[model samples]
Target chain A: MDLVVAVLFQLIYVIANLALISLGLAIIFGMMRVINLAHGEFLMLGGYTVVVATNAGVNIWIAMLILAPLVVGIVGVIVERLLIRWLYGRMVDTLLATWGLSLLMVGLVTSIFGASTATTVAPPLGAIRIGSYAASGYELFLILITIVLLIAVWLTLRYTKLGLLARGTMQNAEMASALGVSTSRIYMVTFGLGAAVSGLAGGLLAPMTGVLPTIGATYIAKAFITVISGGSAILAGTTAGSVLLGGLNGIFSFIAGSTFGEIALLLAAIVLLRLMPRGITGRFFRKSL
Target chain B: MNSGILRQMRPTFVYALLGIIFMFAAPQVLQLFTIINLTTAIALAVLALSLALIWGYGGILCFGQVAFFGLGAYAYTISAINFGGSTWAILMAVMITSAFAAALGYFIFFGRVSDVYLGVITLTVTLIFFSLIRRTSGPEYKIGNALLGGFNGVSSPPINLPWNPTSFLFPEQVFYVAMAALILCYVFAGWLVNTKFGRVCQAIRENELRAELLGYDTRLYKLGIFTIGAGIAAIGGVLFCNGVGRITPDVFNLYNAALTIIWVIVGGRGTLIGPIGATFALFYLTSALGGQSVLNNNLVLGIILIFFVLLVPKGVAPTIIDWVNARRKKAPGRVRRRRGSRGEGAQ
Candidate 1:
């Protein structure tokens, strides 16, 4: 049925967006051992930036490409320097501080933007017809862009000086520091990079999901669930978990309804966490941890 | 000579007595609105104490306690209206909420999940509960007395009060009930924390591997504590609905949970009275500032949280206690005697 296919396309879109968010979270949490609760808020800010830029008459795609990483990265750096720097080794402190920060940011945004959902930025005019099914050109472009970014990230991590240093730090911060690498600088930059990636994700998905102050809260749990289940393997695993969650969500929505669909997703993620403690792609990255 | 001991004892008794007296006498003098606000604060304080038990002592940070609060609220609304307008219906609601929390805790903590993941799991559970219940409340919400009233929620039937039972609560009676519950909860928690089970939990927090090596099952303790915490929070939620005479899904929002955590952290995690005092103080401040622009109210709270977290991470209670201890002058030649009595004197 048309409804079924439409739902399926929407599901794919959700998965792709979630994968992008989770991939960045995986790097920040999995690699750096920092739980940035405000990371989602960063995505929120980035999405708003793109929306504002587009409203000012900039080309939508160009606005996203230019503003997302830069704004998020700068915020990330400042946050690292001012707040997160003091919480380097303390997990609980970091959790509390960032939790507070998340609340503060959400409150500020809500006060400024009001509670109503923002109007979504329009997607570019284009549709690609495949057989009898038609898909938005924008959706296809998003998928392709994600794939390209994943590959590019993989290549960079596989072959680059900064990548090697990052890997070393990920394996062991103390040992890496002892090897004469500036662990402090790496931590700041790494956090910034993670935030930037999240921003990029927000910017790209703004057209699909829209720019709302509390929008991040909707996807954050799903993205976190995906990252936890995907294990810290690579972008592939994150994407795989994303599709698994997103597809299941869509299928369940068709059968049981949207509310039940979300409940099922939560239940499934909990079960997966219980069964696969190490996650789907956990084994591959075992040595790195 | 003995005055030092007497001086030290004054604050504890003074606070207790003042709390009791105020509970009885304040409603007589204050406006009706203030009385209502005070009652709400008591409910919120009780809820904060629940967080203190789980996060403070158990070292399990649950970010979704509002789920249980909401469940208890919804359960009470449904049961009270459907079954009967009796106290027993409310009790059943609280029990059901606890049972739900136990089932949730068993699945997450006993599943060998880490602390951070435990928080995420709890958040997911809360979200699921919110989404499902909000949607389901559409049609069958009202089954006789069991009507959910949809998103609007339900309230207790108004009845003639001996002395305005709903609002005034006969002054002393409601306050006594609150005080009794507080004392009972505090004593029970204190005993539990000093028990062998409590020792195992503390050990687990410090070193999970060593605790396991000591033949203690950490996961089971975590689950037990988490369930207890949820139950305690539900107890507070029940009181909250009764005091307010109504309930809504919004009452169980994530903001309430965050506020509870703020109370715990500011009060000093692991300290019982700290959370209680923090809750009361914060509510008092909120009440004072709610008259002003709402943004100013929130800005004040945000600033206080940021300041306390940065400068006094151990929390107001511990910091104050430390300051008081430092201010006391030690008796000359007492160092050796105190050192000898250190283990016993620690408490």
Candidate 2:
């Protein structure tokens, strides 16, 4: 019984982790139809933000919660105004430009920090015992934070004027512009918001994974897989993809190993894509946001 | 003189002539080390040319061209070890990698999925290869006599003269082979785009639905070009390891993948020579950067990419070509027929 509870916690943690890393990518891709290949770097920037802040003796929670997102959000806006704004309609160009941006960010961070092993940013939370197994309280907190983050995003998109304007612009930019909405501003803000989410997730992840200039490469493929596998609808598709892929990965990793777990996850995604090319929500939650 | 084919192939012949001249001249003038570096650059140029064919011409932006590339290297290494000959092993390796590409492309092109997601699928597959190969440590990962070597990577057998299996090629001889292969592949690609099949592929690139409406199976055509591109890239893979002396899973990493795209983008996506030129230029540039400590290579490349995409979207070759044409127009000459226009002529 304790084993099941522990396993379930592990499964949920994995799901939440995947969701957290991928949510920002989902928003940008799902809403804007722009394939921001630099998304992993955005997350890495967030991690670095927390590292830089905490190294200067700031509170870890405040750095992760506030500073990381704020810094990366600003970076996202600058990226939009400088690079992404020009390559708005060209998806392929957007991918290439962002890829370059990702590389640039890695280079900049490496030059500043000096590329080496992981930076130390230890989680402050203690382990919480459940029956025979002890789980890191940080993992539980991450799971709870992921849920809260998802809810917050949902409320923002559903209730906020900015969200509505962003959605309207994405749906039909010309129509939104005709209706007096600043589509360009919306694009910038939406991109910034996505980056902010990525930043928060990265900051949150800093304690668990540590900060590295190239650390984004590790999460990038998986995050892209999740977002692309989720399809068009931002929230529901992301949740569905995380639950499915993350669950499969967790169970397989537990049964076999990390490598096999990764293989299974990729294989499942390829097969899933073969079946439903548009992604999970492309078929199931077609009506949902 | 009367045939359009000869006139059409004049520039290609000129390119081949220049390549041959360089192949002969460079070894005499440059040091052995420089020649060796040039060999590596040539192999990468071939890789870039492969992308120029598939993505540039066929309109298939394959993000994981390195998957087939790495596979070919590993396959050649393993087979050469087992067979004790590189000639058959090279053939076998190219065939195997192309078959793998065909299978993967089949799943993608025929799956009725939107084409935009193809990049993600290819990248995912390449990453899978990267991670999977990295974990192949220990004695358990040996194929026949060759160890998978895990992360250490296996050294490749040198390409020997086909008539004499015992006579292994020196580094200089391998450079000649790499240059010869590059020239042949370039001419072959130039010839291919003029064929009916290439014409149909270009039509599909322009408008897939319109090509489909004309009763052409766009999927099969894409699969064909994808396989051919894979085969050519496999050949590049074979030469690349010979130049570098070993094959590693790092070839399948995102860096190499991105670098390959950078070559094509900076060279000129739609033109063959553009990417080949870009590959050489950037290859040498990065190699020079690898020697230095002051600047980060990634940062430099990133800036170049952004600069090219924003300012010079048409890329180096087209920009130069346009400039020359503009100059020619300004000079006292009749408005001659435009040689390399946008669509098929871009090659």
Q: Which candidate comes out best when scored by lDDT? A: 2
lDDT, residue B296, candidate 2:
96
Pairs clashing within candidate 1: B81-B145, B82-B145, B82-B146, B141-B148, B142-B147
State the interface C-alpha RMSD of candidate 1: 2.4
Q: Cα deviation in Å at residue A49, candidate 1?
A: 0.4
Root-mean-square deviation of candidate 2: 2.0
Query: How well is each residue in A1-289 modelled by candidate 1, as lDDT tens digits?
Result: 7756666776776677667777677778766778777767888888888887888888987878778878888888898898888877777678768767777777787777776766679877589765577889898788777777777777767788887898888888999999999999998988898888888888888887788776777667777788777776556567667877877877788787777678777778878777776676664445432
Model 2 whole-model lDDT (C-alpha atoms): 0.90
Candidate 1 lDDT over residue span B1-347, tens digit each:
25533343344345556666766677679876766666667777778877887887788888888777777766766666665453655577668988888887877776777777777677767756655555546656465655566566677542223333244344345544655566556556655665667667766776888988888888888888888888777767766776677877666544565677789889987677788889989998877777765574434655566667778898988777767555543545543323231111101
Q: Which run of 10 residues does model 1 chain B get worst, by summed lDDT?
A: B338-347
C-alpha DockQ of every model: 0.47, 0.72
Runs off by more than 4 Å, candidate 1: A1-8, A118-120, A126-137, A234-237, A283-289, B1-18, B140-151, B156-179, B294-302, B329-347
